[model samples]
Target: MVIRAEDVRRSYGETVALDGVSFSVEAGEVFALIGPNGAGKTTLIRALTGTTDAEGTVELFGAPPTDVARHRIGLLPQEFSPAGRLTARELVAYYAGLYDESRDVDAVLSDVGLEDSAGTWYENLSGGQKRRACVGTALVNDPELLVLDEPTTGIDPTGRRDLWRLVERLADGGTTVLLTTHYMEEAEELADRVGLLADGRLVTLGSPGELVARHGGDSRLVVEAEDEMAASRALESAGYDLLPDERHVAVPVGPEEIPAVVEMLEAADVEYGGLVWRQPSLDDVYVALTGTDVTAGGDPIEGGRP
Candidate 1:
């Protein structure tokens, strides 16, 4: 394992940030730490990078995280404030100088699609442009392990797509990447494994497909019948659970059940609009494990209710 954490715990006075969290990352893989805001993802990253002290075992490449390890780790923090007066090239060169074997500054900028903005001052660039510049700085040292926290937070959709390509390329080059992002699509696209944190706990961990398979259900059958109450009652009698919506009836049935449901609807002559079947997605898995919608929240760091 390139990175490992065992029984990690951190507290901020009265609030427990992380409680007995544990997980590991293998070499040449992309691991995502996903959760609602305030679920301890940042705290966990801090612990792993030795930025914060916590009671636990954190090992990076068989050694404890320290200043030497820091040089080998590329960290793009959630909050970044670059020198406004410095040009993109200058900023990258400054960061490169801190490493023993620094990557070519122009190459790193081009890799992040910032070649055109190399001369632009940090203060003059747009939010997304600045984010790309920040990413370039993180890649300047060619660190073995990359840690990105909300890397795509301020980026636009197009910029996000570009960043995704960069992330994939980095992983393909045998870099172990640990990413934290609120973008479900990004996680779905790049992560080999994802860990969900909730209420200061590592709630679940598995491959994206594994987590989906473990929790995802078949298409949701929504029936809007002429007599909603009667239809709900019929579905209940047939072992379907009642959802919050009164006019809709849902059941976790496979393709075979679809035929039966259709036949029953025809036989009963129930007036209905239509039915929709959606494959269970990562969003559904998040809800199932955390009992809270991923979108129900304030800022990206302050997650929704438990």
Candidate 2:
């Protein structure tokens, strides 16, 4: 195992941050940690990286994290503040100089898509560009294990997709990756296995497909209606199970049932805006396990479980 934690626990005063969390990450595997804000993700990252002390065993390459050689590990914390006046190339080079042997500074910059902005001053770079530069510094050492905490926070969608490809390439090159992310799709896109944390607990662990199959509820067809009550009555009269709210009605159905549902709506003269068929996803799994729904902006809204 490249990483291992056994019953790790931490607390600040009376507030517990990590309550007996345990998991392992294998060599060359991309493992993702996902949870709401204030769910001890940062604490766990700090513990695993030896930045802070915790009350359990954390091993990197069979040694304590702090005992492992720094040259063998690369880390990008959630909040990293570099010299704002330095150019991206200068910043990455500075980090490369810390190790006895390191990858070429220009090559690291290219790997992170920062080649075009290599000479841009850190203070002047766009948010996405700055983040990519930070990522570049982490990769300069070409460590066997890489840890990223919310690495794509300020990145645009296109930039985020580019970083996803970069991560895939790194994993293909036999680097172990452990990352924490707020974006559900990020975890689903890149993780070999995902461990979900809630209130300082490891609530679920599995591959994205496995978790979705076990807890992602049923696929549903959603109809945005002109009148939700009328549409609900119409669908119920046609023997369709309805999950109705104020603006839309959801029907759990297989692919074969869609045509029949449309016909029933047409026969009843029910007006709707459109139809959307959605399969179960990681977001649904989170909601099912946590009794809270995450918004598009990644904030959790507490709600009753279905």
Candidate 3:
């Protein structure tokens, strides 16, 4: 195991930042931690990296984080403030100089898609560019284990996909990755396994597909109608399994059953604005487990759970 944590606990005065969290990450596997704000993700990262003290055991390569060689690990905190006056190259090179052996500075910049912006001052770079620079700093050391906390927060869609490819390449090359992101798609795309944290607890842990299968409910056919009650009654009467909702009436149906549903609706003369087919995804699992709904981009909508 590249990482092993058992019953890890941490608190800050009145707030319980982490409540008995535990999980493991294997070598060359990409593991993602996902949850809402104040979900103790940063605390767990800190504990695993030995930057903060907490209860329970956390081992990296069978050794305590502090006992492990620093050159073997790379960490990018959620909030990093390198020297603003330093250019991107200078920032990455400064970190590279800390290790006895490191990847070439130019190569690191190119890997992060920042080669053209190498001379740009840290403060002058765009939001996405600054984030890329920080990622470059973490990669310059060429560590075996890489931990990234919200790595793509400020990146554009194209930049985010580029970073995802970079992560995929790193994992293919035998680097163990532990990342935390609000982006559900990021976790679904890159993670071999995902651990969900809420209120400082590990709510669920599994592969994305497994979680979606277990908690994502079912494949839903949503009928957007002006009269939801009538549409819901029509579907329920037709022997379709209905998923309760406040707005659109949703029916659990297989893809092949969609035409049958449409036929039934037409026979019953039901009026619907449109019909949408949605497959179970990590986003649905998040809502099912956390009692909150999140947008595709991972912004939480603060409402009662469905």
Model 3 RMSD vs true structure:
4.3
lDDT string for model 3 (161-252, tens) is 99999999999999999999889999999999999888788999999999999998989899998788788889989998778642688988
**Model 2 bad stretches (over 4 Å):** 244-247, 295-306
lDDT against the true structure, per candidate, is 0.83, 0.89, 0.89
Runs in model 1 deviating more than 4 A are: 221-276, 297-306
Candidate 3 CA-lDDT value: 0.89
Candidates sorted by lDDT, best first: 3, 2, 1
Which residue pairs in model 1 clash with each other? 37-301, 37-303
Q: Output the worst ten-in-a-row residue range by lDDT, candidate 3.
A: 297-306
- Tens digits of per-residue lDDT for model 1 on 1-306? 889899999887777888999999999999998877777888888889988889989999988898445568899888789999999999999999987889999999999888899999999999999999999888998999999988998899999999999899999999999999767788999999999887779888999899889985555777767687777777776667765522467676666678888777776666677876556777778888888866564433333112
| Two-way lDDT contest, 1 vs 3, winner | 3
The estimated TM-scores of all candidates read 0.84, 0.94, 0.92
Error of 3 at 53 (Å): 0.6
The TM-score leader among the candidates is 2
